[model samples]
Target: MKTKICGLKSLREIEIVNKYTPDYVGFVFAGEKRKIDEEVAQTLRRELSRDIKAVGVFVNEPLERIAKMCEKNIIQLVQLHGDEDRDYINALQSEVEAPIIKVIRVQSVNQIKEALTLPCDYFLYDTYSQHSYGGEGKRFDEMILTEVYKEDLSQVREGLQKPYFIAGGLTAQSISLLDNRLKPFGVDVSSGVEISGQKDEEKVREFLLAASKVS
Candidate 1:
């Protein structure tokens, strides 16, 4: 599975993940525990290798700010994880050069059905309930994902389909199912690797290694 390390903060952590060579390195542009400021993001952008994509995570940020951050940070990918609608997303896509990944909170079958209608470069399936929108670090009912989770690769490649990144509460225990059989475009992880609000290198390494073992 292509891996994306989100909630990234320190240069040391980003450098550690480089050995694993994760496909995407994300910076939290909003929310608590956000390690860096706009200036930090700009600096980190230069340090990131061309091969490794950079993503900016925003939670219902103003369009002007989002546009500015994307430019200032030089991030090429945008992951929106809030109540942003199609118009907001479309506006960003039109303004920014980066591709947009819309996060869909999976709570029930109906939510899944509605997710397919969103216009985005990628679809992120995350845990959601009455309380939050995304990044809660708790899992939703995986059984609800059974149909699409088990669907064949060919079926997943058909129309209205976009790349998939399974997010929320996925750790070593849940990484195995993301093998080729599952055919997820990538995996998105955050709190699963934390010890106490900081990125633990050992946990990060193990998570990557375990996920890499899947056939």
Candidate 2:
């Protein structure tokens, strides 16, 4: 499975990821704690390895602002982590060419099913939290995946059509617990690889190694 190391902020963090090199690195443009401004994001993106793609995480941000960020090549992918509907996604798509990853705060199988109908390039299934948009480090119920399949195992099943990343409270041990039937396209990590609220190089290295072992 692919690995995405999200919530990167400083130049040192950029250097660490460049060396360890997860498939993708995320810059939080939404939340307060790990949030980075446009200038900082641009600087970090430039220092990032060309092999790794940068993803911008947002929570109900203005369409124009997001489009501008993409236009400047600060982030290759956009991850929506809020109450953005199909109309907002459609409008955003019309403005930028960057691929969008709509985050489905998985409260139920129905939410995942509904999100599949949206016109985005990818899906990121994260644990739902009323207090925060994401980076909560809490996993959602894995049983929901089984429920989705039981509900509709059809060829036209929209949920299975698109690729998705799984996030929230993920670690090397927790990743091993993932059901084989619910094969995610990739895995996203934030606090799991952190130490004292900062990205730990060893933890990032260990997580990446673990992810590599996953089929």
Candidate 3:
């Protein structure tokens, strides 16, 4: 199973990622406590190991700006955690070479159903948040996935272009809680891996180790 560590802001966090070496690391361009500008993203990108892919988090950002970052190799993947629709995704796909991972904020099963149809490289299922797009460290009822799987397991597995990641308040224990039969493509953690409002080395390592077992 792939593992993604999102909302990274500091060089220290980048260094921690380097040590743990998750499949994906995120740079939030979207507004939040963890948001970073393009310059900082570039520096972090440079600091990141070649093996770890950089994912740029955006919310309703201009297509050109995102495309420019992709073209310049500042980010290898684009994670859209906004109100971006199919039209927006279509426009972005035409302009950039980087793969897109659309975020589906889940408050209900209907939202998951809706997200299944979006044209993107991958889908990230996260908890619904009124005040934030994601990275709020709040988890939704993971049983929603069980409901989806029960409804029509084969269809969701086959129809989805790629394996999707589960995000929002994920911890080592939470990762262990996932049903073995319904494993996600990956698991994303941000605040769960943080200690005292910052990414902690031990927590990062622990999270990665736990995720690896399931992956």
The best candidate in terms of TM-score? 2
Report RMSD (Å) for each prediction in the order shown.
2.9, 1.5, 1.8
How many clashing residue pairs appear in each of the predictions shown? 0, 1, 1
Clashing pairs in 2: 137-169
TM-score of 2: 0.96
CA lDDT, candidate 2, residue 208? 94
Residue-wise lDDT of candidate 2 within 119-197, one digit each (tens)?
8898888888888887489988878865775556463377577788999899977888887788789999999999988
Sort the predicted structures by lDDT, highest score first. Answer: 2, 3, 1
Local accuracy of candidate 3 as per-residue lDDT tens digits, 118-183? 789988888888887774888888787767756664545554446788998889878887777676
Q: Rank the candidates by TM-score, best first.
A: 2, 3, 1
Please write out the lDDT profile of model 1 over residues 32-64, one tens digit for every residue: 676467788877777777788889888898888
Model 1 RMSD, rounded to 1 decimal: 2.9
- List TM-scores for all candidates, in order: 0.87, 0.96, 0.94
Candidate 3 runs further than 4 Å off: 153-158
Q: Residue 183 in candidate 2 has what lDDT?
A: 75
Q: Please give the CA lDDT of all the candidate structures.
A: 0.76, 0.89, 0.87
Task: Estimate the overall C-alpha local distance difference test score of candidate 2.
Answer: 0.89
Deviation of model 1 at 65, angstroms: 1.9
